[model samples]
Target chain A: MWSWVAHRVTGMLIFVFLFAHVLDTALVRVSPEAYNTVISSYKNPIVGLGEAGLVAAVIFHAFNGVRVMLVDFWSQGPRYQRQMLWVVVGLWVVLFVPFLVRHLMHVFA
Target chain B: MSTIEAPRTQFRRSRATRSNYELWSWVFMRGSGLLLIALVFGHLLVNLVLGEGIKQVDFAFVAGKWASPFWQTWDLMMLWLAEIHGANGVRTIINDYAEKDRTRFALKTLLLASAGLILVLGTLVIFTFDPCPTGAATADVPSFCQTR
Candidate 1:
């Protein structure tokens, strides 16, 4: 139940970001100066933290989505749903920790 | 317990009345989810985790990437897939939450309109993009433009 909720929440958040991201990328077409001016804000510390959180949301959503697919398709999936959730968490930690470490360094640097 | 049907019962569903739109959407969600994992992870790794990370992202950086047909196709594919996937996800959410018929209809219409606009706009931007436009300060454009 919690997993489902998290999936929905994260999915919504990511979608929102995706919308804004497209707009930001579109700035490149306007002019190089316009694009660079906007993208520079992304390098600041606060937005950097937000970027970390955005990545966290994306990683969780991606891993949990695979779990949801497994539950629907795999024969033993339902039986191991709980265990699979744990696996999702484990994988998320594995991927996210490195991203956080690397990204924070760049952000703070 | 079997119950007899009333004379006016509409018991049979017409063979052609069923639509597989929802089923296809379900399949698409899973299939696209898998593809998005690869596309998005690569996007993040290249744009945010590599060399200067986000700091390296600027007009020149973008110009350099899109200058290659490979990254342009990669980003174009990513743009289309991610937008459609996101629009569908949000449509599901709107259906889940907006209980009233009018509210649901209004919200969905708005959602589709915006998503469609974004898709069209983003596509145009990608294909029509120029690394350097005449009359812009040379400093703002990619270095390659100087050779022209």
Candidate 2:
């Protein structure tokens, strides 16, 4: 139940992020100065931390997405979905840990 | 949270309906979700990791990427897929939570309208981007432009 809720929440959050991203990026066609100014606003520590949250959401959504695909596609997969969810969690950690180290270092540096 | 009006399970649709729309929608969500991870990660890898990260993402950086047919297609897919996926997801949520048919219809209409507008604009700009417009100040241009 939590996984389902998390997936829905993360999907919505990423969609919101995508909308904001496109709006700021579209500013390039309007005025480079405007675009640069908006993009740089993201450089603030608050926004950087928000970006970290964005990264975590994306990572979990993507990994759990794969597990969802497997459950839908693999033979006998739905029968073992609980285990598959655990596998998704394991993969998320493996993929996220290294990226988090470098990403946070870059963000705070 | 309102016991005044009970939440809906789904839009008024027969469970035994022969149409495959919901099935396709479910498949699309999983399929598109898989594809989005690749497209999104590749995008982040190039835009945030390849160079100076977000700081380097300026007019010239954008101009350079849109210059390629590959990047244009990549972005186009991301725009369409993510918007459709999100809209569908929201439609599902609305069907679940909305107590009134009119409210559900209104919200879904708003969702699709905005998604459609963004997709149309995004596609147009990606394909027709003018890297160097005449009459623009050189300082405002992507530094690579010489005669702007």
Candidate 3:
């Protein structure tokens, strides 16, 4: 139940970010300076933290999405759905921890 | 009470107007979700984890990557797939939560308009990108562009 909620929330958040991200990236076409000036702000600590949060959302969504597919497609998926949820959490932690550490280092650097 | 139609029964609605849109959308969500994992993970690793990380992402860095056909295609595919996937997800959320018909219709119209604009604009930017625009300062453009 919570996973479903998390999926919806994270998916919505990512979609919002994607809307802004594409616009920001479009600045590259305007000019290199235009793009760079906008992108430079991304290095700010606050924004960098937001980036970290975004990465966390993406990682969880990716893993949980696979779990969803399994639940829908695999014959045994219903029986193992609980186990799969744990696996999704496990994978998210394993991936997100490394990403956060590395990304924070870059952000603070 | 209305009787629940059995699976695969003929529709009361005309076949011309009705299609398995939701089923295809469901399949697309799963298919694209898997591909996006690969594409997005690689993008994150290359952009955020590899040497110098976010600091390395400048106009020059972008110019450098897009110079290669590989990254251009990679990004192009990522953009289309991710945008469509995200848009569909939002559409689903709107259907679930917005109780009023007018409110749902308004929200979806806005969503579709914005998504369409972004898709067209983003694709054009990627394809029409200039690695070195004429008259830009030497410092702002990629190093390779300086030679031209």
Q: Each candidate's lDDT (Cα)? A: 0.90, 0.80, 0.92
Clashing pairs in 3: none
- Tens-place lDDT digits, model 2, residues B1-148: 3554457655554457778999999989998988999998898778765666655676778887886789989999999998899888888988989989899889889888878878877877887788776676676566668843
Off by over 4 Å in 2: B1-18, B136-140
For A1-109, candidate 2 gives per-residue lDDT tens digits of: 8888999899889878877777777887787677777877777668867876887888898988887788789998789889988887888788667766666666677
DockQ list for all candidates = 0.81, 0.52, 0.85
In candidate 1 the C-alpha lDDT for residue B113 amounts to 88
- lDDT score at residue B1, model 1, on the 0-100 scale: 23
Name the candidate that leads on DockQ: 3
Can you write out model 1's per-residue Cα lDDT over B1-148, one digit (the tens) per residue?
Answer: 2988778977666446467998998999899999999999999999998888888888888888888888888888888888888889999998888999899999989988888988998889889988888777877778899999
DockQ of 1: 0.81
The lowest-lDDT stretch of 10 consecutive residues in candidate 3 chain B is B10-19
User: lDDT tens digits, residues A1-109, model 3?
Assistant: 9999999999999999988998999998888889999998778999999999999999999999999999999999989999999999999999989888898898887
Q: After superposition, how far is residue A96 of candidate 2 from its true place, in Å?
A: 2.3
